[model samples]
Target: MPNLLSRGLFNLFFGSKRKAFEKLPGPTPGVLGTLGDFIGPNPWDVCARYGREYGGVTLIWMGPSPGLVLNDPAVIEEILLTRRLEFEKGNIGTQIRPTVGDTVFIANQGEDWSAKIKVEPMAQPWAAAWLAALVGPLQAAINESVDALLKEPSIDLTPTLRRLTFDGFAVAAIGEKTPDSVFEDFMLLAKGADARLQAKLPLRFVSFPEGFEAAKERFYGYFTERVRRARAALNPSAVDLMSWTLREMPTVSDAWLGHILGTLFYGGVFSTSTTLVGAFHQLQKYPAAEERLAAEAATLAGAPLTFEWLRGAPWSEAVAYEVLRILPAVRIFLRTPAADTELAGVKLPAGSTLMVSNQHLHRDPSHWKDPETFEPSRWLNGGTARDPAGSGYFFPFGRGPRECVGAPFALLFLQTALATIAARVKVHVDSTEPFEEGFFFGVVLPKGVTGRLIARPSQAASLPGSVHPSAAVKTA
Candidate 1:
């Protein structure tokens, strides 16, 4: 990374002078202006504001880096898919490489990214099996937390869900139950690393990077232990994610696996939690969905959620997609121009950084019918995909060769968790703990800053064969 500016310095000093500008596809800018508000209301606000003025491909100068803000689906698609070779994952990838090693998010273009995304099965047959395996454990975990909530009557779903996600990932990925300290390890490491990078935090003073190193060691020890246990136990029927990870191990190194797991967990737990939290927030604003979902779940009294049920649950999927569309867990996805190229016809010089803001594109009116309205029905036709090939439109799991590798796993996990909880209890937001809306180490998360959330009971009932925990929930 130190070599980045060094190589570009020559271009900066004596390169061809081309006046750069953002050619926004739309009109009417928001409050987020380059000269007006450097620090906009939120990351989304910044992109929304800039996107309105500059259109499809805008420019965001965050500190020293010049970011090409790609907020349209067409342009984003072209960059990510049509002309993907011309782009690598930009700044965030390099910054996180030191910590995450190099997997998908941290991997530059070419063999590394291709290899990572390839091992995972495409979005089809495995989707059913994957979600089926996940639904069983995920439901139990949600039930464990929700049943405990009955003791107090309410709790913030954010942190509780984070723990559940960690447990699910640990069990699914390595076929092992993670220690409580591991959760602490992730929160500490992810938050610490995010704070350091975002605020330009220095590591030398307090050994921040070393602390991350220690966390990595602990996580790696666990990863190695679990994989060995899974491989040695080799009951083909007992296979889980360890089998999947191991299958791809030959092409990848232990260090790569460690960082991938770490980054995957950070990404999985944080993004799912954020989207769920956002879902609850959206639900609160409109309580009708809560009643409808509960009522529907109640009707399937004798029918436990089979893989078929998940497929048939179009309304649930619609709501989930709507929540993501309105409030995408990740706002900014950065891609570096590997070589000089014209994006949306703007001649972005080689080595230029592109900051694609899904946040603004999510709210774009041209592609969407009612941009601000949280109408899940819009997604009933599929997604907010005005153009399937366009990248600037909507990509919760991203797209192309460098898109999210674990998307199938994540979708399964999230769907099961949401279904189980929504079926059993209603999440009522009772606090004003603001969700920190910013990019954190290549993913998005609720601000890890301090605050408590409150939740209360509802009239939701259990489906067939679903286990209700006999113990009370404990709040720490």
Candidate 2:
């Protein structure tokens, strides 16, 4: 029968993946071997638990394929920093290719070489400048959410915060304001895209929810027009990311522009929103940490949120770092050896898939004192800041040249957004329902968690200034 033929083919393909790294220990096998480990409802948590039980280096399954996961920091560092040149993006790149296209984030080492060279340099400096410039609009977006929460008896804060991040990033990155309908459609498409990628199926073969493709096309058209407008404009002071890309990277194509914009939006909605929600949940669980953060935030009650202010707030930064440490938005990162290599004494042939579990590495007992505890004070010693691109023990955004380009902006946004909200309101977790785990795309998010916001007594009014609207140019 056709079913038997399919099963035989699946086993044949999966068997080779298992044979490549057969020396490693992993989850207990079922009738179909490692296939059961990944076909469950919450694969990320299941894999993280396996990493904990099977020592730092374990072989796991991504559907039928075997993936080698590294939780040891030295091995992680070697693969991510020192021996980075010997690896490529691997399955993660393949998973995200349909959604992100072939830009720097998902581009293989030698394939999209030219586009990588031209586009990679623009992300970092522009991230730094963009963070400093967009505080007003960012704050305005945050304030709207905060104000709306003030009016609600009890509301789903996840969607509200997610929307604010998307709107803020749309203005900051794409140079246009996304209407609610468009934003909704885009998010739906993004979720569908993420589902397809996570399923590791060919996108063309999968059926998406209604309107997913249309929403995707609309965003493409929108970005294409923005590029055209930027080209036609003569303004030297334009501040959005599109203007910077057009001005500095003149030869970049409209397709590349759209890819970059799509990556930014995807990150803004998915990673940043999840991190903030988790931070808020932690604050609710630990009032002392919240009070300490608010006290630190109170120091700049009415001061305009600037890069300097964000950098200077030690407690705010600490809380953010602690949240990231405990509940990293990006749980797993992938790589494969570009050449035959040995990792932690095991020989890995070229093209062997390797996964780094941020969740396991972060909570590894060797890295911290009582790693499970939610103690923000641990990060505040001697004014050390947690880099999203790991220093040694942490890697929320990962490390090396291939680390997230949006990291600088993401950190600043977290500090500013957290401080901006904490300064004015005290958030209490609505504990009627217990916290549950959220599996979205491939990352973990806060589920069943809600908060009640109360005005902090004697707090100063919101910093004065309306958010600057979309313009060809604005003061940076």
Candidate 3:
């Protein structure tokens, strides 16, 4: 019966169009097409292999649905930037809808999406000041996490970073720190969403772990309450994300606001935390880079860790960019054509999925020098690396009109966290083994990676109040 259904789907999507994708290269599809490949242990590896062996544009079959893996920078630019309106979130958006609801993160290109983007909190010009105001709260959160790390010398940095990011995001976006229970609930919901994505099937068919529904209710309820409170205290001068969002779009529904806040929290917390883990891991591996960052941090000793200060630290910003380039949190971006289109001489049907592999593009030899090497200097000015701003090759935050709205805030948070930690302690990854990358609720993270922190005595005196001076000096 399943085989018959698979065959039926195959014929329905590609009865006569199979010939169109015949020239493109990809792994042979199974009875369920390339759906099996994506649900496997390492779908990212499959994407990398497809790009390496199949050239710039590779055809993939998602069951009956035909998709393209786009590795070419030029092709990506055309799809993501030039003809962006021609594409919408499509099936991928549907996959995420169960988790984030109909928020801007996964909303299709339409009037609602347009309105959501216009009022997206982090993308606003005043977003810098809002994020700047969060430095104290963010730093306090980071300090608490670092303090805990100091007590436990050997620990998995992933969880520590996760807690830090969640707390920081809460303070910045929700206007207060969330309880640990709420964080756990959010993780539960996020994990369920990731499971749905991997299933590559409709949400109805995907089975989640026990407590999933309760977690979802709790997570959404928390955000819903936040929206209500923001509405009650609506102020034109309020600078927090929820307040700002409400001020911009007063007529928006409470559920819509809740979903928007939930999506931002989910998107910001997990991805940012994973990126921080990767940054710390990379810093440990490349001591020279660590030294440079520490020195840069030292220069700003006693200086307030303001938004401007964090953004102005060139080497820290460069290292953050390098880590993002090498280990992008979001490995794959999914887009679907709103109308039938032609890409690289191949015709694509309307609604066909377009997958862009950041992992492949970030390391593509043609676009990067020493692509495999962990070289932070590549992002430095007057260096050999192309400027990511002008260069289409680097897009960890994605590109086009629908790019991650929290990009500026995320970068500032990353730069500040990296600089703060580097100044106070020297990171040492306990595991000498090469990192084994895996997906943690759709975000890329290292598995079983443990690290220790040694106090840097030189900068202890200059450390902030939140960061314990005695603990920093005694942690080693």
- Which candidate leads the pack in lDDT? 3
**How do the residues 371-404 of candidate 2 rate in per-residue lDDT, one tens digit apiece?**
8878888877652544334765688888766677
Considering TM-score, which of the candidate structures 1 and 3 is the better prediction for this target?
A: 3
Model 2, residue pairs in steric clash: 86-338
Off by over 4 Å in 3: 1-17, 26-41, 63-65, 200-202, 224-239, 243-258, 300-303, 382-385, 389-391, 459-476
Residues 51-127 of candidate 1 have per-residue lDDT tens digits of 88767666543333345667677777777788888787656654555555555556667787667565533332453
- Can you tell me which runs of candidate 2 are displaced by over 4 Å? 1-23, 27-30, 39-41, 61-66, 111-114, 121-127, 174-176, 200-204, 250-255, 337-341, 349-351, 383-388, 432-434, 459-476
What are the RMSDs of all candidates, in order? 7.0, 7.4, 4.7
- Candidates 2 and 3 compared by TM-score, better number: 3
lDDT of 3 by residue, 110-174 (tens): 68779877767677677767777777667766766777677674778788788888877877777
Q: In model 3, what are the clashing residue pairs, if there are any?
A: none
Each prediction's Cα lDDT score? 0.60, 0.70, 0.76
Model 1: residues with Cα > 4 Å off, grouped in runs = 1-37, 60-67, 120-128, 201-210, 244-263, 300-303, 381-392, 431-439, 447-476
Candidate 2 vs candidate 3: which has greater lDDT?
3
* C-alpha lDDT of residue 439 in model 2: 68
